[model samples]
Target: MDYFFAVVAPLAVVIIGGCTVRSVKIISEENEALVERLGKFHRKLESGLNFINPILDTVVLEDTLSERVLELKPSQAITKDNVSLIIDAVLYWRVIELELAYYKVQDIEEALRKLVLTTLRSEIGEMDLQKTFYSRKDINKAMLRELDDVTDRWGVKVTRVEVQEITPTPKVIEAMELKRAAEFKKQADILEAEGTVRAMELLSTAIKSQSNSKDILQFLVAQRYVEANQKLSESPNAKIVFMGSEPLGSSMGELLNNSTISPPESNGSNSKSK
Candidate 1:
């Protein structure tokens, strides 16, 4: 009975130890495993049950290979218009190539942040302040493209770039505001001048079309006379005059004779006498 008990106990312990050693593995929902054999990369393990030889091979490093957000601090940059501004940005990226991401770059986050800043300065340095403020989306897109190109070799993928904040100096802000105001005023003046020119052109066209019509001229003159009469009646110090050709002189001779008036000045008679 003693011999049988010793043999059975040793067999059960060995089985339990083997199961425990085989159960050692990494479990995750959103991660990948890099397996190594003799300190050299052997294969990549996908999500699920991953087995490893605990004695001969081991998990040298555990890395969560997923998308990450890199926030950058404000950096001084010079614009095309010689204005200096501090710009802050955020970068969205992911590690696509786990092999390159883990082995090539020492620190992925730091490298990504530094690359973003360098690319942003180069892009923004070529544009003016107004463009930088308004064209942030466009600039971000361009920076993303540039970063993608440069980082592709390093196995890093840049998903998107965003300009978080742009802070220009107070003096630069004032100058930009003044410049914008002046530009708006110039545009308004141009529009007003165009409207006045259009109105003048229409008036000239109407005058030309009615040059041979006496009725139209008479109506215009009557309208002016009515307006003048109404304005004059509002104030006792105003005087209104509505005149015509020699027809009034011929028909109303008695009225002209009663008033202190002279005949129409004749240039021909005056020149002949001189």
Candidate 2:
């Protein structure tokens, strides 16, 4: 009886242990899990061990899925005006639909890669190089919106799309740089001309105010005389000096004496003399 009881006790303990054994589902702090019961989705589960119908329930990994990244290769495209350009971009995205992401597409990575390439080419073809470079943020946003709208049904959300780089031909870049430089030079010239006009107007006002003012003229003349003397001192030749206003008056008087004053003769004068 004791031996039979020991054998039964060990067997009962093994059965209970097997029945109580639970599958541990480990989840990271940043993750969530979706559980299925007999091929039907039941509910989402948080981190730690939760009860499941042993053979009938299974946990689907929603967090283990890698974040999708789409890299668009450089492609040749024409602008609105028929100018050619090479453009490339990168897109960041992830699957929000665990069911659709796994079921809708055969290969999510391959599908996204093809979609990104096609979308990029189509979008870039409609824009010019100038618009492509200058309005890149707008372009990226537009692409993101379009991709998100299309991919949402497939359980994908486009988090971000960015224009990584744009390379214009060397000739086009050089032409643009030259055009900018010329515009800057033209503006500088216009400003310089305006300044010259302003300076001339101020000088004219000064001259008009000083007009016929003997004191001011005398002062200017004295200044000029001083400058002239200083310059003459540098010359090797001797300068002829005429002293003051007195010498100028005497010279003029001598010139007047040398000239004769002639009077007109008339018939009336002759009659009066007779």
Backbone atom clashes (below 3 Å) for every candidate: 0, 0
**Residue 91 of model 1: what lDDT?**
88
Count residue pairs with overlapping backbones in model 2.
Answer: 0
TM-score of 1: 0.58
Local distance difference test values of all predictions, in order? 0.77, 0.71
Q: Please tell me which predicted candidate would have the highest TM-score against the true structure.
A: 1
For all predictions, the C-alpha RMSD in Å is 10.9, 13.9
- Cα displacement (Å) at residue 127, model 2: 1.0
Query: Over the stretch 246-267, how does candidate 1's per-residue lDDT look in tens digits?
Result: 5544544555345442334557
Per-candidate TM-score against the hidden true structure: 0.58, 0.50
Question: Candidate 2's residue-wise lDDT over 1-274, tens digit each?
Answer: 9999899999999877775675555666545677788888887666555666557778765553446677877866666766667778787888677677766887877787777767776777778776877888887877887788788878888888887877776676788799999999999999999999999777545645653434343455567666777777777886756357566456655654674333344567766553
lDDT of 1 at 188: 100
